[model samples]
Target: MAVVRPVRGDRVRVYDLQVQGTSNFFAGQVLVHNCLIVDDPHKDRADAESEASRRALHDWYSSTALKRLQPDRNAVVGIQTRWHPDDFAGRRLAEEGRLEEGGRWKVVHLPAVADAKFGADPLGRAPGDPLPHPKIPTRDRKALKAWWADMKRTSIVRDWHSLAQGDPQPAEGALVSEELLRLLRDSATKVEPQKIAVAVDPSGGGRDVAGVVGGFLGDDKRVWITHDVSAVMSSADWSTAACRLAYEANAAIIYVEANYGRDMCSLAIRTSWETLQRDGEIPENVLMPAIDLVTAKQGKLLRAEPVAQQMVQDRVRLRGLFVDLEREWSTWMSTDPDSPGRIDASCILTYGLIPEANKGAIVHAPLPQAPVSGGRGPSQVAGAYGRRIGK
Candidate 1:
């Protein structure tokens, strides 16, 4: 094995190798073997960030690369610096269950700098300690710190954490930050809601999960997310789940996204509500929540941006920890291919609860107005308006 500089203007060429003795042999300057070695699987930064590119690499590895390995003899190895959370190495680790516990792969994670959050440093370095390098003398702690500081200063937070710390996070490009979510969670307290609603983003029997999230407008003018029943289910199942959540939360309205299946979404909820009432699942005294079909006139990112800003302004709270929903909020990016159903539903719920977040384009439903003196309250007005819209 050796490193040799290519001659200027050298033409690129490919050659086949046939080792005579050992499994390994020198090909040009580098040692080569029949064993599969995926070095920096992603082509570049853009490729690493792209979902399509990641999937392509994953497919090639699973379908093509694995087949090329010799049965019971040849080994597979992958080496890469962390990029996105869904990058090739990340996906491979997740698929093999190595992300959570011990699995097939023997992972040796060596970040340029140590971080305690990822686990103890393999080199026994404390958090913030730089990885030992010959270029920076071990005795020169000031030089080492200065070098890492320069690296961090030059790179974006996401890239610095991923490429340098080996802890990839959808931080810079993410719609919401985990830190903000945590702050909201810490400040949230149990308060009797003034108005409650359930929002749904139907999957329409597709592979995507149907999102059913419930939230309430607190007296403090903050929207608090209380429930997330999002799942991969049939039309009937999701509708039923949405209705059940609404019933449990005593939600005054059920807001369903109607961009795709306008009538189907509304009809499903109404049908489920009727079925629930007829079967005594819902008591006779409890009136069914008004079903309001909402249509989005803007792109998802545009619709969600206002709500994210509201979160930043401390207008959104979580009644408790919603793990999956929080994960979606913290990691979802505009460039991501698949629509995040949970986020969609949460945005709808937020827009419904905090009318200011709607920004006029994301929702078609009449924004519930504040109560006038000697008139119906906001909930009453909203319920009446919902009923009128339902009709």
Candidate 2:
């Protein structure tokens, strides 16, 4: 039996304990007062023969013993959050209320479980990511208000508790965008692959560990994340895993972010591949090649924004192996706090689509066609009704 009473609040207490049918009838009397409240009333009646159990608890509550404990008329508030309003406790309280005609007991209805819906981090981070402690952004304040309003209106949503709010450990990324999540749910599917490329974001040096991602680019530029192996491992160990994934995917191009370890990533991957090949233990038939280094002049923030636009425009399609990217997308947060998952995956997708020399395509806006010139310049054109120009 666990009793949860508020230490700070005045005249408020909560108790949660499992007791047998015989024990429950007198449990309330243990802490009888002028105002007694009960929660989850229906659960206490599930196994008991409803009518008998109801009468037993009530008879005991209104007994001489309880009357002596609280001589005045005490208000028994049954604040049950059960789904069914006709459960034993609810029904008993209703009966008592009727018999006493406004004094003995009151049945209050309050829904217990609630959903915590998430919205986009306007500051550009993923959902569940923490803001710099105590530095609440204006956008977050707005999002909280919006979430409350939404919950009030719908009354049927609950947070994915195990993942979002279940742990005492703080969440790490910007809230995943609803629009992007909806798009992913609607668009993600499985497909066979023709060409494959693996991108590695190694974090072995710092508090962050390492994330090696492999994506299969099929016909029509549809991309499927084939693998997302993120863990704390030595450079050599991570290299072995990366090679294994590449070989399994039959990937030709291994793209490693060269910023962190530079040439070390490439060397480690090649060394691991050679070791595996010599040992005759390589799992797949694909040739293990040295990783190609991909340089980024811009930061991750700038790199991912364009991809988000592509997703919204339906230019990007995410298929299988989306688990890691999905988690990343669901947790990416900016300094101001926004999710950048779609953007990060988009960078990988875009890099595969457009070459460095062809970055022109990414920034191209069709030049607006120069407004067609309208047959004459301003000096030669006259106003409507034949008025002279500049008159």
Candidate 3:
């Protein structure tokens, strides 16, 4: 706990409220674990060994990598780390499943970036790790090397830990290249949304940025991103902002992650829609669109991989400039839980666009609202957003 001196000289206060003679946590009782991926044959044999080696090896990236390593243990592990070394959270999850005697413990390493669609690598590997130079364009190679050269001296955390090792935090690396982003962008006039959806990843309740992204199945058989209404708003404001994005997109469905407050988010979005209707914003014919609550079963990186591929394959296009959202996509490696709000929104949007993937996941409202008319431009919706939604 005594890590560094505070800047503002504000002392940390601690008060233990445990009743007298009540304690569960032990002191210095290290529980050695022989962990592996769920199905690692080598680890499976190792688990049967009477004196199994305490050492375990795996990279921080995806769980699929560990599946190749056969394992047998009562407890499975999945570590979400920015580095190779064990973090507090990883240890805590392990501790929860720690056995006093008989239960075999297996911890899986999960290396992920906030925006799987963007970043250094799946394992967060740098360019020059195993190669003198990667196959990047000459300009990009030079830029990367130059950035690294400057960053090594300037950066507190260098590539040795990230390049030679695993970790995305501290360095705060970029995921997507300029070419990739430019390639995904299209002329606003050329792209038109046929079936739109708004995706929201709320921050529960805080001054954190709420990701609100809208896009639709394009006429070109691609997913076209329309807008990014993400902002660092209060709970009330963000909820309304989310609905505003949905309204502006004329989205048939508003997909909200229920990991936070399912009821709270649902109510907030509905309230915003009702407000817009009261102000005669959307046409009366446009009934309240279906609100679908989603709960993510897979990791963020896994969920985002398909969407990333679509963008890389030129199957995803941006209708307009969303600078900040692009930055979030370009820079976030899944180190922090909530840094890449925009990217999270992208994952939700992509899932909704894929019919098979979205099957049985969405719950429609009984009363279907009228569809949005393409006659009016997004400007009217934007104005309504500014006055009422933001208000």
Best by lDDT: 1
TM-score of each: 0.53, 0.46, 0.46
Candidate 2 to truth, TM: 0.46
Better model by TM-score: candidate 2 vs candidate 3: 3
| Candidate closer to the true structure by lDDT (higher is better), 2 or 3 | 3
Per-residue lDDT tens digits for candidate 3, residues 222-318, read: 7778888887777778778877776666667788876667898889888887887788876555666677877653566555555655665566677
Q: What is the C-alpha lDDT of each candidate?
A: 0.70, 0.46, 0.51
Clashing pairs for predicted structure model 1, backbone only: none
Clashes of 2: 27
The runs of at least 3 residues in candidate 1 whose Cα sits more than 4 Å from the true structure, single-residue gaps closed, are 1-169, 186-190, 360-391
Sliding window of 10 residues with minimal summed lDDT for model 2: 364-373
Highest TM-score: which candidate? 1
lDDT of 1 by residue, 1-391 (tens): 3322221121111122223334543222433444555666665555676566778777866776676554443445667778778887788777785523867565678888787776867789888888876898998888988898898887756667777887777645676776677666732243556778999989638577788999878666778788999988889999999989987877888888767787988888889988998999977566778777776535877877777777776678876778778777776666655557899888888877776677733222112232212222343322322322222
Ranking by lDDT: 1, 3, 2
TM-score of 3: 0.46
Task: Quote the positional error of residue 238 for candidate 1 in Å.
Answer: 0.9
